[model samples]
Target: MRTEISADKVKGDFLEKVEELSGQSIWACYQCGCCSSGCPVAEEMDLLPNQVIRYVQLGLEEELLSSKTIWLCASCFQCFSRCPRGIDISKIMDALRQMAMEGGVDRFGPVEISPSELAKAPQQVLVTVVRKLSA
Candidate 1:
């Protein structure tokens, strides 16, 4: 993806909002790759944990917010456990998910699925999806 980064973008409100919501210093991450290395679902993510943090740091709001990595996070805390900076990546992911949902970016909902598919879906999976994806 070709993104144009500027000083204004790096100092934008989105970065402040993310820091406020997640309560983590976005600049604290040194990109040691520990978080990504320990992430069990890293392969499935569009952006790894460290890459997500870098995106936030660079104020790539559109790309970061639209990423599937935020929603795909399992909140297993594996990334946090491995982070040398003690940054909880799961919390950041949660904040990103919240921001995305608030912005009306629905990843999953009744409209996206067929009735037959919804009917065949596991009850637990449906419940989890509703809890996570619903605004």
Candidate 2:
């Protein structure tokens, strides 16, 4: 497939870092579909695991960097373990997640809560439990 991104589109070491961290060069993927078949989240992904690998191979930076599938990955390592080529599919997803975050796409979804909001739960129950334990 044709890609919108040229070699000049990527800046600095982003793609290099992705390849390093994922432990498999994009060129090594033969599109055998083993990774996609074993992926638990494959059915839910906007692009299948094999497709994502191909996009990366084509240097489709924008598409790979902004995909919802990157965040949807639960990091279960199933895909990584099952890949016949031994490509680290989970790490590829992780790298994609980092790229997406750096690009400000917010992979957690449209209305994800901020860290501050998640920490504001009531503390009274904890206090009561502590007091009871102390008695």
Candidate 3:
């Protein structure tokens, strides 16, 4: 289970976008894995919270957007509070969700909600579903 990370492919603008949109510097993350350690759901994530920051730092926009990790985030803010660098992992998750939405839902993983079910769901629930499932 080896993963190859190409720093050469890191997009400057993508990194900038994460910082600019989220108002949090991705470079601030030192990859100490504190965020991941604090994440209660990290065990269920395809990529840990710390890994998400690494993806942003490396400008791996496509990889970040395609990952199920961002969608699995509980947004409990536990990781954010525990981050030694004070990085807002939750905000980064939101930024990733926004990017996914901008790319269109198809760029994300498969979703199995029927139109009728979605229509019948509450507004906030629908919004959360779309936000999380969009990626």
Candidate 4:
């Protein structure tokens, strides 16, 4: 929650890195809720798609990188389809995931899970987990 925004933070390297990685204009988003509204996994996300863009614009690297929302994105492109600015939220999420992994903020790995838990997980869940880890 509580984040301190300063001029330096607004113009930090984090913002540039995200933009470069995602290849999207982070400032193009104007807080419109269309991306969040159309996100299929919005209910499962800690931060909505639009909020993630806002965080990037503000250069809140720690908060953005730590969010589960980035990992939750399914890259279905629903947000991109609905965005008035044609922003592809999935690319942004991918960039954030990359940044988080670079910072050693991995959620978990298959090696860390018990065999019993792994067996209990659905096939789709396991596949997604493996995909995220590999990415």
Candidate 5:
């Protein structure tokens, strides 16, 4: 597979964008592992919550984008609430996922559906299910 991996490549604007959306300074992360421990989906993730933060800090954009951990996160807010650093890990994940999708990073494969893809599905069944669950 063709690939690209570069460290310390995060553009300043990219960091600013993420910081703006997450309301957490990326530098504030202390790697306490609390986010990973509290994450309900961490066991199923390719990268733990703390690992994700580390990747972002290192500017490992491709690594972060290719990781399934972003999708695995159910965004239940446990990580965000339990974080001692007060870093909004969920929001950071959310920002990264959005940016990755916009950049056509292919974090999820062509046939694999990320949650964002579910919104574009022509079938109403999944939407109905989500609605019922959210209700």
Candidate 6:
């Protein structure tokens, strides 16, 4: 989707808090798109890693929280390693996901899963979902 955000429209304070919580500075990102280019799942995301950083910088909390990218992220740190500024983009995604869950998005949805279905899920997926939702 095409979008526009002016500097005055950005929320400086929220950006500061994200940095404080994640130990990664939003200001450090230069919008170089390196993070997005390097992200393995970037093509599958509604918003690329670089765009997510911009949303965080602009304090688009609701948009960021609702994005599919937050769930699609593998947290493999490929973007972090590729970043020229060394920003931990995965951590930021994690933080946004935590916020989303806290904002009432169900991790497993409203429908109750059968015990057999739950048992069939991969152990790693279960652990990751639990960790992200609990954060």
What lDDT tens digits, residue by residue, belong to model 1 across residues 1-135? Answer: 788889998888988999999999989999999999989998899999999999999999999988879988988999898789999998899899889999988887857767887889988877777777777
Better of 4 and 6 by TM-score: 4
Ranking by lDDT: 1, 4, 3, 6, 5, 2
Query: Which candidate number has the best TM-score?
Result: 1
Q: Model 2: how far is 15 from its true place, Å?
A: 4.2
TM-score of each: 0.85, 0.68, 0.76, 0.83, 0.69, 0.80
lDDT of every model, 2 decimals: 0.88, 0.69, 0.80, 0.85, 0.72, 0.79
lDDT winner: 1
Candidate 5 lDDT over residue span 88-122, tens digit each: 88788878777766776544343444678677766
Is candidate 1 or 3 superior in TM-score?
1
TM-score of 1: 0.85
lDDT (Cα, tens digit) per residue for candidate 3, span 5-86:
6756574688888887789988888889988887899888988898898878777878888888877886899988888888
Better of 2 and 4 by lDDT: 4
For model 5, the stretches where C-alpha displacement exceeds 4 angstroms are 1-13, 105-135
- The runs of at least 3 residues in candidate 1 whose Cα sits more than 4 Å from the true structure, single-residue gaps closed, are 110-126
lDDT of 2: 0.69
lDDT of 1: 0.88
Query: By TM-score, is 1 or 2 better?
Result: 1
Total backbone collisions for each predicted model: 0, 0, 0, 0, 0, 0
Q: Name the runs in model 4 displaced over 4 angstroms.
A: 112-128
Model 6 gets an lDDT of 0.79
Comparing 1 with 5 on TM-score, the higher-scoring candidate is 1
For model 2, give the 10-residue run with minimal summed lDDT. Answer: 126-135
What TM-score does prediction 5 earn? 0.69
lDDT of 2 by residue, 1-135 (tens): 345765665443555777986777776789999888888888889889889888776667777776667766776788778877878887787777766666665534313444664477456634533322221
Candidate 2 regions with alpha-carbon error over 4 angstroms:
1-15, 109-135
lDDT of 4 by residue, 1-135 (tens): 788888999987998999899999988999889988888888898988888998888889889987889888888898899888988888999898988888787776767668997879888878777667544
